[model samples]
Each structure stands twice: as C-alpha cells, then as structure tokens.
Target: MAKVGRIKLGSQGLEVSAQGLGCRDLSGPGKPEPDMIALVRHAIDIGVTFLDTSDFYGHNANEVFLGKALKEDEVREKVELASKFGVSFADGGNKVDIRGDPEYVRAACEASLKRLDVDCIDVYYQHRVDTRVPIEVTIGELKKLVEEGKIKYIGLSEASPSTIRRAHAIHPITAVQVEWSLWSRDVEEEIVPTCRELGIGIVAYCPLGRGFFSSGAKVAERFSENDPRKRLPRFQPENLEQNNTIFERVSEMAKRKGCTSSQLALAWLHHQGSDVCPIPGTTKIENLNQNIGALSVKLSPQELLGLESFVAADSVKGDRSAIGLATWKESDTPQLSSWVAA
Candidate 1:
C-alpha cells in the first residue's frame, strides 16, 4: 500500500492525515460495537489519524462509541479528533433545532467533552450556522474555548462565503466542513474560493455523494427507513432516475482509470487542491480500505477536464437535500450587525 499523506489545516499548523475517517455511522442501531471499535483502531493503525464525528450523530451515541474506541491513553493521542455542535434534537430525536447562543454554545461544548471522555477536542465546529445568531458572537464563544484550552482550533460547517468571512474576521477559522463532491459543486461557486483566500481549509463531508455516485440509483432503494438521505431530494425516485447519468459517467471513468467509482470520486476531490480533505465514512473495513486507495489514483489533465465537462453537460437533477432543512443554502447570508435584527 502507498503511504498515506498528511496536510496542514489553515495557518494554525494543525496537521491531519490526508484522508480522515468520518465516524457518524460507525456506531448506530444496527452497527455492532466491537466491530466499530475495531474499525476505528484499524484506521489509526493505517495512518488515518483524523476522525470526524458530531455530538448530534446517533443522538450523542457516536461520541460515546469513540470514547470506548480510543479509551487507551496512548491510542487517543494518535488521532486528531473533531466534533461539532449547534444542532439539537427534540421529541425523541425526530425534530431538529439549530442553536448558537452563547449559553447553548458553552453547554454543548461541555456535553461533547463529557460524551467523548476527552479533556479537549482538537477541532470543534458549529455544525450548522444559526442564521438567528450573529456569526461574530458564535465564533467569539469558540475563541474563548480556545483560550481556555477546551478546544485547540475552531471550524464551521455548511457556512456561506459571507458568514465565513465574518467569522474569520472575529478569529481565524481553521477549517470549514461542507458537502463537496462531483454531484455537489455548489460549494465551488463561492465557499471554496472564500476559504482559499482566507487560508481556511475545507473538510469535505459526503464526498461520495451519500453513496449515490458509487452505488448508482439502485442504492437509493436500499436505504434503511430511518436513513436521513431518504429525505434528500436527490434520493427521491424521480431525481435518482434522472441522476443516473452522473453515475454512469463516473463509473466509466473509474473503469478506464482502474479504480472503483467511490475512489474516483474521492480522487477528484483530492485533485481539487491540497487544502481540501474528504472524510469518507464507512462501517466496513473493505470500504475504508477502498477509500484510502483513492489517494493512489491519479488523473491526467485531459481526464480531469473530461469529467468536469461530463458533469456540466449532465448536471445533477435535484437539490442536494430537501428544502427548508438546515443546509448550505439556508446558511448563506451577509454578516449581521445585531442578532436582534436577524
């Protein structure tokens, strides 16, 4: 196997492995605990030193899984652990709410720390931008956590270009986590450029397009009843049928390149720039190994252009997610001078 590489996130000098492990589904209703722990430890053994999880994932169960996975003092020191807050669950995890108030921010951080059983998180993020709260105020509280050693660096997720700038002005943002893939190029419009100019690294989540690009439309039907992607517009039957072109094109390219479609998707993100890192999550070690192999698939300039042109000609047919949900579109806004006016 080729040696896995590492990249520095922004100017904070926080280094993470080139391919981070997204731990959202590692532990869940159907996932076995021992298997999940073994997968995490295996990832570390192979140099995948960055782990991404959210406090809201599995309704706080994911962090607890990590706590058990990395219980050993020496094992915990090998990875750069990142987690997010700002989203709260209600009505038994059916209803979702976004909160960024100073009080909630503090409370959320404390809760995450306890759940993960860690003294401090390496990178803490506001999972979703709360349009009602001023970006400055939200980041200001994070800055205090950094000062007090609760978190080493700050990050934002699904934030707009304007919001990113506003937050960065208050304090340097180490990274911005957003869904960026062949099927999700909206970020390239403004978010990517802004982060580049501001020296903020991008942690691309869902880089496989929620398994759509790799598994094709048929995968949509296999989603569990509770799977969140079932609610996404792109996964609907009509949209999925229309989006088959994307899968076909990517599959063709992967065959020519001698890589799996999933690997091709990840390699595309890798080719974008050194500042972009995609944290592709999976419960199976085979899938994890395939994701890691993406680093080795090189694309020629013509091949890259061909893929881009193919996507441009046969664009994805639906919104990334259902409207009115907490998403990148909802977070795009100019900085507010007062939260009261928002």
Candidate 2:
C-alpha cells in the first residue's frame, strides 16, 4: 500500500487518510457493481482508507454496496467508514424532505448500521440541516449514538458557520463536509474559519469541482440527462463557457507543474491546511490512482498563490447548485431562539 499521510479530525483523535474516497457515485443507476467494488478496494490498497457516502445516495444502495465491498473482516477493519442521513424523497422523488428529529436520527442510524453491516460507523453525518429541527437537537441524538457505540463521531454537511458552532456546543463535530474547491470558495469566508476555531475538520466534497477541473468544461457539456451535474447552474451552457477559463488556467498550471489538473486541484486543497481532507470519487482504477498520486504532488508557496489568484471566487459564475438544493448560506446560522420557542 502507498504511504499516504493521515490527519487528525477535531480533538477526538479521529485520524483519517489525507485523501478519502467519495463513494457516492460508485453505485449510481446502471453502474457496474463489480467495478465499483474493485475501485473502492483499490482505493483502500492505495492508502485511501477514508470512505464517504450517504444513506440517501441511490436511496440506501450506496451503503449496501459498501457493505458488500467491505464484508471481508480484514477489509472492514482497515477502513474508516463515514455515512450520512437526514434527506429523503417524498412523492416518488418529486419532493425532497429533510428530517433531523431525534426519532428519525435514531432510526436512520439503525438502518444505516444494518445496511452497512457494521457494529458502528466511524463517522455519521447529517447529510443536510433540517431547518425545522434545531441543530442542537440533531447533535444531541448523535451524541447518544456515540455513547451507545453506534457511531464513533458526528459530522455536519453544508452547515453554516453559526449552525456549526451551535452543533459543536452540543457535541464535538468531527468533520464538516462541504463543497470546497478551486471553484467553490464560499465556505472559506466563514465555515472554514469556524471549523478551525472549533477544532472541527473539513471533508471537502467535490474538491475536483465535479469533473470541471479534471476533465475540462468542454467534456462537462456532455453530462447525460440523469446526471445530477446537469441540474447545477455552474454546468449550464453559458456558465460552463465562462468556467472554461478556470479550467484553462488550471490545465496550464498543471502542465507547468508536470501533474494532471486533477492532481493539481487535489494538491491545492491539501495545501489549504492539514485539517482538510478531499474525498474525490471515481469509478475507474486509473482515476483513483491519479487522485492518490496527488499526495506526492507538493505545490510551493508561489505555485499555490498562482493557482489561488487564477481561480479566485469571482472568476467562476453560477450558483454551486440549483436553487432548491440546500446551501450553506440558507441553512447556516439558524436562530436558536426560534427552535427554543418551538
């Protein structure tokens, strides 16, 4: 196995590999099962032991798929598995609902545990904040799971800075999974600083900008009808054309640095801080290898600055997701008094 370095998440002593495998896309519709399993195992073999997935992914299929892949006692023992809850479909997937009530929290943990076929999940995240439920209430339930040995740590995904502080006050949030990449720097203004202050680690999902940086915008235009990226504002035709400049800059720097654009992007994230881990997912072994190779692609101070200046936040256009998708701005900083009154 390659010797990728590890970093500590929060003060709980939860350490994971520098790069985690985002397992969400592994078992999507019509994807080959065996290839997905092989890709995950290959990730583990290459020192990518931290796996990120959610219960809602493929409507629980991702967890079940991971359960099968990690069924071997040794394989299960070697990996630090993280899965999430708190998003479900209604009206046959037309309407989306977010639940964080204590009852739902306990039930979700139980279902995920059974689906994952593990005694305890290493890290369990609330996939998205349920605005109806207090952040404290959600973390309180997670705290119970930790006490009962159902989960080792708690995480929040795409939560705002204020919500993170409130949740941490209830229970130490082990990680905050968000979209942090060359294109998406919205979290840096508040979320990243809050996590650092509270000792909460960051798990950067879409660190490659959802293939925008890796494959280029031209290729992104080919997203199929069912592909989720097609729904995102950034991947729309005009926005994609504008975003092509960001990719062009990255590609140019990657060539100068003698690394792939994907590797450069991952390396840029690594340079952000020791507490940040990027989980870039792929179904191909070659792409998995390329992601792992990022561990060795060190960027000097000047190069890091160059890339940062090239893809500054304003350089990219379009919202990170479509309007209805829960975002950090809308979900962060809930009024504690409102929940208290309720």
Candidate 3:
C-alpha cells in the first residue's frame, strides 16, 4: 500500500499519520507479547507513527508495552504518542474518576511519563468529562503542565462541546476523542462543527464500531466477555440483531467500492471532514495495513450522503452508549445530566 495520509492535530501543527494506530490492542487483548511487539513495530515501519493509547488499557499494560516498543525501536522522536488519564486503576479495571485538580493533573502526567518512559507526553488527554469538576479547572491544570513542558499538547476524550469550550478557554484543547463511525454519527450534529470552528482535531475511537462493522459476527463472538464492547448497548445480542442492517449497508457498499467493510466505514468517516481522525485498534499487522489503506478508498459525493442518510435515527438501532453514558451534552457551556451520577 502507499504511504498513509498525514494531518495536523488540532492547532499545534503536529503532523501524525492520517490513519493512526490504536495501541490499546498490544496488551494481551488476544495476541501474546512477542506477537504484539511485532505488530506494533510493523505498523510503525509502514508509516503509522501516531500511536494512541490510554492509561486504563490492559490495566496499564498499554503504556508499558508501548514504552518497551519505543525504547527497543529507539524511535521516540519518530512517533507521536497520545495517551489519556481520568480513569483510575486503584481497584482494577477502568472506573471513571475526575481528578483534574492541579495536583492530580501533575501527578497523572508524571505517572504517565514514567509508564510511557518518556520525558514529555506528545499529547495528554483527560479520559472523560468529570461532571463533578468544572472543565475550566481541569484544563487550567493542564495548561500549567503545558507551560511546565510536562506535556506537549492537551486533549479531551468523550467530552461535550460545552465541556470542550470550557476547557479550551483555559487552554487550547487540541483534540476530542470519541467513538465515532458510520454507526455513530451523533457527533456530526454538533461535535464535528464545533471542533472545526475551534480548530480542534476530532480523534475517533472505535472507528470500526468496536469491530462490529468490520469483523463478521463470528469474529465478534470471539471477543472475551470482559471486553468493553461486550457490555456496550450495541454489542448486546438483541441490539446487534437489530443493528445488522448497518453492516448489510456496509457489505453492500464494500462490494461496490471493492474494499473491505472496515475500509468502507473508514473512508466514509474521512469524508466527514479533514479535522476528523480515527484510530482503529487491532493486534494484527495485516489488519493495521488494511486500516491505513482506507485513506485510498474513495467515496463519491452521493455515496457519502447516502451513508449519512442511511444512519439516520430511523435506521440506527440501539443506544450508542449505555443509557447512562448516552446522556451527551453537545456545547461549550456547563450541562448536567442524571446519568453522570450513575
């Protein structure tokens, strides 16, 4: 395949591979350590330098594995590392925590620094919106880190536009990471336009619908019960039964485009706007290559519009997130929901 496309993340002018690598899969998601290392290095060898991970991945295995790989390859400068905080590992697994106070922010950055084995974080993001904590306070703390040169840039994940605005006002928030794809266009109505207006990049996690759109039903079934997707609304059996129509549309479009379903889904996303970037995770080198190849998969104007309309409210099946997590606020002002308490 040709080289992957590259784009500027937010306004920092840091260029990363258009099709970034989701490093979360490297920590025993399915593959072993040796295999995972090979997959990661191979991905970078093929020009995927934007490696995305989070502190909560594999109970902290993601950062550790990435650090080992980066040190082994001696390509710290060659790769752009994007990692997140906010989820605590004190009790095992991911539990939402909104400790964005100045002290917590400094400690988190320092902890991520040690785990990543890097002096500076290429991009540091708050893993989630802490409704209990004002975003300005959280971002103001991040701004201190930026000024102190602890992190090169700041980002937010799954934050509403108002939260984004509140945080950005304190500091130039670089990107917003959300689980956006053909299956989840809810971000289009507000997040997309707002990010574009603010010059913030949109990093799309689960760009393949957490493997729902790309992998066949049989493969999805292979995911361990502990997999986060297993608990998500769309992945539930009943919900999936009703959601297969989305894949049918994908399969049909893939045939016409002469690409895999994953490629079709990713191509459609890239068409959404230049400001959007999707980091689809995988533990296989071949799959990594296939995902990056999506940059070459072209879609017609009619195809784009058709895909959008196809995912309209009537066509979409179940809640994008669990009922509680689905309570999305889409602006730059403070908004509260009953779900935040859940």
RMSD of each: 1.7, 1.6, 3.5
lDDT of each: 0.89, 0.89, 0.79
Model 2, 1-342: lDDT tens digits are: 466778897778899999999998889677899888888888888788999988999888999999999997579989899999999878998777998889999999999999999999999999999988889888888999999999999999989888988999998999999999998998998999999999999999999989888888876757887888888888888788878888898999999889999999999999999999999988898988888888889898999889999877788889888878887787753455666524
Clashes of each: 0, 0, 4
Candidate 1 lDDT tens digits, 168-251: 999999999999988888889899999999999999999999988668997887888878899898888888777887899889
Where model 3 places Cα greater than 4 Å from the true spot, the runs are 90-96, 326-342
Better of 1 and 3 by lDDT: 1
Give lDDT tens digits, candidate 3, residues 201-273.
9899889887887764555577776766676777777777767877887788788888999998899888877
Model 3 poorest 10 in a row by lDDT: 333-342
Q: How does residue 15 of candidate 3 score in lDDT?
A: 78
Instruction: Give candidate 2's root-mean-square deviation (CA, Å).
Output: 1.6
**Candidate 1 off by > 4 Å:** 91-94, 332-336, 340-342
